[model samples]
Target: MIDSVKTPRSTYRQEQADATRVRIADAAQRLFARDGYSATAMEGIAREAGVGTRTVYAVFGAKREILSVICERWLERAGARELAREVLDTVDPVERLRRSAGWLTTLYSTDFDVARVLDAAVDEDAETRELLAAKLRGRNRVMDQMISSVEPELSVPLAEAQSMFRAFAAVGVYGALVVDAGWTPARFESWLADALVHQLMSASAVPDPAHP
Candidate 1:
């Protein structure tokens, strides 16, 4: 007698369900970016993705969960600074400071949807205040690396990098308020570029006592 081997039906169904969840999330992201999160509904996402409304609720539970997923994706892309790391590797302190400050301006500028969603999300959901705090930790880590780029010229101990990082974060906060709050984009970028460059140069101007 020959024995028959069979593939599991549940395995195929699980893969299909996972694909459907991804599609729903992508559709919701596009809508949320176009229309603010409050305006985008589960039915809209279902229609956009060609799935049933039940599918969206089944996968995401609520609209807030979907918004959180989209915001997470947006921040990941906006703060990606690996290119800055490579170029800064060969550059001197002056050039590295310029590049680092310029990169911050880019990150805070309206070029990315995260900048817009950030304000809107916080206003709508109190829970997202914590989400923003978590994202702040990530931004601080990036700023710390930028500070390290200029550490050779810093007058204080390496631990003082935290202050320099905070100054950079202030630049970002002001940049977002000025530009995203309807201030002139050109003037905001120009002013921020000049201010951040000055701050970094001043903070790292003196030679590190620790180094000497």
Candidate 2:
């Protein structure tokens, strides 16, 4: 008979620490969204989370670090890693763009407030600006990967492809259409899919505009 391995259980202390971390992060996100990043403080987060300020500081060394954690948590919750894998694994260029649009729509819809808050703060704070710059760089890297994946089917030059990808798949575009213009998430996704296919794909690869 083969022996089965048992999963290790979390200790009480570990569980308590995990709960406190969650509380701090949740409080921070709420405050950041409501008050903007510059106006929110670690002390306020601690008070909102019902923990000591020292505990918040000990768990997250700085306010920026907490913001970083918030971003990470949002990405995880948005299923970004899994979506990236799905996009990469897809071989069809049109399908890849569609998947990418769906992923972006879901991401923006889930964290629009956080993105708005960060954008508002980035202009005023050096640290926030750096963080925003890093995020844009990461987004560009993903776009580069996506462009490379669909290179064989592209009608445009790589630079144009990059530009088209950024413009069509931007979160702000989604926000404008879905949040401001009152389009449904499904409508935004369909429009993005059609727009990307028309802009980047070859004539042969472009799906019927009316069908998307």
The most accurate candidate by TM-score is 2
**TM-score between candidate 2 and the true structure:** 0.86
Candidate 1: Cα lDDT at 118: 54
Clashing pairs in 1: none
lDDT of 2 at 170: 61
- The most accurate candidate by lDDT is 2
lDDT (CA) per prediction: 0.67, 0.82
Model 1 misses residue 105 by how many Å?
4.9
lDDT per residue, candidate 2, 66-98, as tens digits? 888788888888887788888989977889978
- Alpha carbon deviation, residue 35, candidate 1 (Å): 3.1
